[model samples]
Target: MTEDYAALVRDDRVHTMLYRDPAIFDDEMERIFKQAWIWVGHDSELPGANSFKTAHVGRQPVIVTRDKAGAVHVLLNRCRHRAASVCERKKGKASVFVCPYHGWSYDVDGGLRKVPFADGYREPVDKADHSLIALRTECYNGMIFATFDDAIMPLAEWLGPARKWIDLFMKQGAGFGVKTLGEHRFRFPGNWKIQLENTTDAYHFPIVHKTFLSSLDEDTENLMDVLGQGGWVEDLGNGHSVMVMIPDLIDLEENLDAPIPDRFAALAAELAAEGHDDDQVRRIVRAVGGSGFNLNLFPNVACSMAFFRVLRPVAVNETEIQHIAIGMDGGPEAANRARLRLHEHFQGPMGFGTPDDAEGWERVQRGAAAGDALWVMLNRGVDAPDGRPEPGHEAGDVSAETGMRAAYQMWKRMMTA
Candidate 1:
């Protein structure tokens, strides 16, 4: 670690090089991401047997697949022969992954299936030693996570106090587990941790998204106040945290057919015609409307609004993010359509919010290299009126910097440990 690394992270501030230094970024990939339980894909993504999705765990390409026997596997994408990628597609159903370089193939369970032209081998090619490498995988609800360190704690245990929050989050899908409604992928010239910190950092919403809010139908003034109304930021331990909107003013269970908010009046008829009773309507709306808090699950996966923002670190100063919308798998088509629209309105590349965030993160990366400032402040709510200590953790106003402080505290732990 560089002298700047420790000097950068203090109790209330961090230095600029934390985001701009290539060497430091490499260290983070090894020390933090490699050992952490990273959310790779939702089980819903690989719905059928032999279904697979290509994903990353700490810069390593892996294939998360469901075998014919219904068991799930997280296998390295690298071919056992010549280091070529056996699977090329981002995701789809495949009986086996065939190496493009030499036709060496592996089954969905990651067993070496064939080596073309068998006579070419002099010795009995030790097939047992050459199957694709697999990482340990586990799931909670429908979300799947994988880790390179097989000895690390299981995913459920690792989620720590964040488990109940996951339960609360998945409830947005009601009894029907949420399914992916596709995604919008984009890259930003910024570090992945910057995006991670941004998710639970409610303090920036009012200032950074001011123009976006004012354009919406809701009362912009009170809209910002929603962050203050009943919400509190909480650190959920093990790098996970939440900006909880308690009493769930925005969640579905509370909103129901109670005269739809004026902003979503256009969506009311569609909700009604779905043939659901009032309570049913509420659940439908809540599930599809993506009524929940912002859940930052450590290294990746941010449950925000109608979508999950997934971050992939491509380089020291480059990050690729995916915006994934969710809705009940077997739910009404109209409600699902509405979910997709809402996801697009606020989160997609051309939407009301994401582009602005892109620019903001890029700005942070650029700014870090400019000045000689030794510390970037995360001291918004350190004491008194701004900060409120709670059981097992701390709390603050929705617009407070409590979440950033919590995330950094976790970051320091992972990067140091």
Candidate 2:
């Protein structure tokens, strides 16, 4: 078996083994996931002082919580005593975590707080040395990210050129922050990278999501016709990129008084009745509308439209996706309701879009299993208007493979680093 990771990713194509081989997946977990900053959860999930949620980073179970002091912390869920997870629930408000396997208790900051008995062994165990492992955590625009490698670059610098696009995506919330409405989780028999690439994959939308487009109003359907416009895909460094179609929707936060689109005709007067001013009405409308940029944030997250899609790799060929709907924090109640419906219509188990995408991923997995085709082609638009002025920035059409090439460029660098 060859361990040449470089040869797996070419300028125009990638090998199937990158998505199928168990060895390659494990290597990715170690090199890419552990070392890189991975998003865990949003700060909005922690509403109060003791709010906490469980997440995974590179196969390690983690607890993301706000301590009694109101500071956020990301601690390993594994108990030091018996290696059992201290936090069992997915999310809750807990002052401390108690290991079910043993009576060892830990504070929100993962400090060893108590044991069943203080004196049982001849040697006095040092509590300082038995603290739960904690990762370096940072929050940017309410998104929480953690890393096991302390030597990695600062989170702001690490996000690199991605910060601009992230700022643009957040503009849908219009000055106020966005909160997680809820999440829908589903597992597929495919590698996680399949979904990662799918986020910025504009080429598949017109083909795979044709049903979704057909159901939309003709005016709204026009939004999907960005393929012919001057729209372009951008490689935003550090494995991040965006397939942008509607540039006008990027920073509606600045133009709060912009009129609501025709799609929200039913909500305009209702918003007026709710005492919303013109600016606030526009803000609420944008929150309900959606973002045009499908912002893929490297290893784990895709801030797509109005939802946060997270990818978790469970095994070599198995992956789970968490689709979280986001709504403006203080927006009109009616607008938020419409936003939730929009998310459900597009992303949930019953949604029209996800089922089609899941089928696509499964087909790719099955085809790769044959080992007949060594290379998966990503050569679309390669001979067209492709521009790479720098190492981490590139430009091409909305349906171009610029994102995949740029992502793989960072992947190869990180894997071989």
Candidate 3:
């Protein structure tokens, strides 16, 4: 069945075809992922010069590297000669990237450094001409992002309202800032949009994550329930969005099993050595925000509390998700371990949350294969609250499908452009 892209979306609801259609998925890769300032990795991921990580901007393979001067660069992974990926490993520190196929090598800055048998060529391969294709890379609050399209707007202008949410997430550790706690990668036999929608989806939590929530103590359950009740959902413009569920957790009674991590203790000790008092350290660690907040950056990044989730599409019906957790850098080792444990609880492949969500997404994919399922209703709490700033919320309001709607709206705009 042919799908009307415009008709598939209304202010209050959307059709399932938006999620199921292969054509729409291809268009999104071009108009959305290719053009958008997709999150590549955190600044902390590449701690020093020569550190690099491979990531995908849509289906195109890209590499993010830190040069000797500590400058970050994003380059197309293809070799100039025959288009083979220069960096094969997922991540590592290297002064230069060498292609194993034909021994073509480039510096960490993506400058063409060496080519095997250079003298044999009639037209000398100009190092500048054969340099790896570079992408526009920028950082905000230590988060790295790159755009394939040179004409795209600056990162700050594109961030819009989403910057506030990122600021809040960053504020968690305050001056101590945050650091990634590695990641867990998994593949889902479903569309990537299915996972993106879930990032801001609050309605399904109480049901889908019921068992997981039940595992937590009463206090945690109360917080989860509060999140289910209603929370902030905001469209931060340019398809970026934030779904704040609960505020900072400083007020909560510390559960025995969930005590301040020993890493925090080490951090406190370090702070003490640096002349900070006990109170100051306590305040800093406590303020490292983690209650229940989910912040989504446009097409692919979701910063949820202490963790970040990146949704990468492999196919119309296949997706790969990477979950990365972050904590204060060199802060208390205890706190960092605690954050890792917390991430493990929900983000791990077999963790309480992800596996459950995966099941739901797989079901959606199976249902969509029928072809007769025309739409996926997003009419939750349509009349329950008018929390949006505009006349009609553009997906990002309590009980609102603001994020989903914002994504589709951007999709339609870009596709039609």
Top lDDT model: 2
Clashing pairs in 2: none
- List candidate 1 segments past 4 Å from native: 1-5, 219-225, 245-247, 254-258, 264-266, 384-395
**What would the TM-score be for candidate 1 when compared with the true structure?**
0.92
CA shift of 214, model 1, Å: 2.1
lDDT per model vs. reference:
0.78, 0.84, 0.77
lDDT of 1 by residue, 26-136 (tens): 988887778888889987899999899999998999999998887889999999889998877999999989999889999988889999997888986688899999889
- Estimate TM-scores for all models: 0.92, 0.95, 0.89
- Which ten contiguous residues of candidate 1 have the minimum total lDDT? 384-393
Any runs in candidate 3 off by more than 4 Å, and if so which? 1-4, 228-230, 248-277, 284-291, 371-373, 383-397
Clashing pairs in 1: none
lDDT of 3 by residue, 68-157 (tens): 888999999999999898988888899988998999999988899998998899988899999999899999999899998899889989
Compared with the true structure, what per-residue lDDT tens digits does model 2 show for residues 266-321?
89879988888877777667667878778888889988878899999899889999
Worst 10 residues of 3 by lDDT: 248-257
Q: What C-alpha lDDT, on a 0 to 100 scale, does residue 64 get in candidate 1?
A: 94
